[model samples]
Target: MRSMLLRARRLLGALLLAALLAPAGAMAGPCGPYTTGNIPDCEPQQQAPVPYGILETQGWAYYCTGDHPYFWGLSSSYPGDFTWDNSCFSAIENVFPETTPNKFDATFTNWCLSAENIVVTLGCSSQPPPGFGPSCNETGGPVGDPGCPQSNISNHCSSTNPPVCFQTATETCSDGTTYSCTADQGIVWCYKCG
Candidate 1:
């Protein structure tokens, strides 16, 4: 009778061990049926597109004492022609002189590009802060600042399947000045200021 109890206990332990280990083994098995050589015939992994946009930094210039700077502008992205406009001004609390006397810096965070193109423009107002003139060359152009008066900027994909994405844009002012900006993996990689 004692031997029978021992056998039953051993069987129960073996069953429990198998129960605990079965799920792990199943998880380790090939995703699909194995080939004749026992190699996994798995399907190729599909890569999903990561949606993103471009962010432009504009409006960094020298400021006069007690003279707050303002940034007012419009930004747009193409392949879909989405647009955004904003106005930002410096208050006594936020405006301060930089280490270089009479110099202040500000940025324009507008527009994003998921796929194709991005266009950003600064200096929309006629009375922009001193030292903050229209950087783009705008000859014979419209009266007021026509935000980034350049042509269409393009972002090309490297591959179709699991495509590598890049975002870029060029700002050409009326004065024949140029600035280039690029984005990779949802972050601005380089922004060449005029």
Candidate 2:
């Protein structure tokens, strides 16, 4: 009887071990879209798209703060490469709406000058835009002020009372939830997560 009891104990330990290991697979899946925040080993995306376009290919909207020093020059000079579709130039323009609401006229209208121009514009930033510097917190120009129209928000902005900036416009999340920006002036706020 003692011998049988020992065998039973060994069987119970094996069952427990299997149970512990079995659920690891399910846990990884239930996590559903792991972020770098949770997984320390995960690497940052090798190809970080510069924020541009009405809808990022990865399904994100972008905003900008006129901080890109050479953005205007690049956009004006490099017509083929600079525009709303490029992600780097688009980063500020894409994130604008979260704070200022309805600020990106170009995005509101769903304008796409050409897919090729948009592609060229991505990953091409020699200088920062006018308002933004190295940091998002640094306030440029007047306080309580809106900077230039982001490519995404330009069209609708000119028609507003204060000559509103388009990047300032806000948008609802894909989940249909509403969230406000932390601040209005310096940083361009992105509403959704990729």
Candidate 3:
């Protein structure tokens, strides 16, 4: 009789475990406080048509500035239910640059691509800042006023000796002409490389 009871207990435990591991929505009901459409206002707003062109650029610039309160408010409206086209993030992907191995990443899709040895950082630091390259160039805005237009470019030289070239930062030459500079990540840019 004790053996039978032990066997029954084991079966019950196994069944309970299986049920718990199943998908949370298997029951499919109003699931207490959070119903299907009952989302809070703080969620990112579902972006319409994914702002493209300069509007997209401006949106990304705004998102980059964490100080904006609307950032979180706008994000809260995103539908938590599923991951769709993700048109909302297109601006960010387009404005910034992306790199690939043996291939040039012309369009910006995501940040920090290790294959191309490219990493974009926030604020002026040892690494290239977010808007350091054509992103800033296309926008035609001063990189920043932090004592200098902090920028750099790093890129594969495709030659011997200096297989990798980098430039920290530079200023305009005495002749009032700007020069080109390279950064540590092999990103090539112009900024009076004197």
Candidate 4:
């Protein structure tokens, strides 16, 4: 029988090559509990949607990290419009640096997103991306908590209020831990991820 149909076509090609070589942490990321992937230890996040009357008026959130990145400093200095108004920024690698509504799905509260936006800033170009200790700005300023509080309606934002912003509380920063914050003008607000 043609060697039993070539041994059942080599046992169905070794079970589809063992299910495509499994083990990317078993392709974790039904995204549940923010189950990251993409094997960079940066884990895979992926989110995209940033436009709402221009949140905090351009020029990114200036968070920081991505290791040494040449010791930072490249903000055209108080020069607004780093683009986002034209919208289109999610490169999708480690996306859940929290612009809004990740953790796999929580009603995507726009303007990047929130209600516990997991602060990243690992490449530190801007937009909540700084790095290298003190957990890098401890989730981004105004004594951050990044877990989104102040009665999280995605922590209420406002540049002209799409969902309205500013909840600003839960202090104890300067490395004392204790997070959950707000404030965009009183200085880049942030904390809370783990």
Candidate 1, residues 84-173: lDDT per residue as tens digits?
122221111113322221222333343543232222221111122234333433233112222464444555443235544444455666
Q: Backbone clashes in each candidate structure, one number apiece?
A: 11, 48, 23, 35
Local error of candidate 3 at residue 28 (angstroms): 1.0
lDDT of 3 by residue, 57-112 (tens): 23222111111111111122211212124333321222222221111112223222
Model 4 deviation from native, Cα RMSD in Å? 15.4
In candidate 4, position 154 carries an lDDT of: 29
- What C-alpha lDDT values do all the predictions have? 0.32, 0.30, 0.29, 0.30
Question: Stretches of candidate 3 above 4 Å error?
Answer: 24-194
Scored against the true structure, residue 52 in model 2 reaches a CA lDDT of 40
Count of clashes in candidate 3: 23
Q: Which ten residues in a row have the lowest lDDT in candidate 3?
A: 64-73
lDDT of 1: 0.32
Please tell me which model should have the higher TM-score, number 2 or number 4.
4
Off by more than 4 A, model 2: 23-25, 28-189, 192-194
lDDT of 3: 0.29
Residue 82 lDDT (model 3) = 20
Error of 2 at 97 (Å): 35
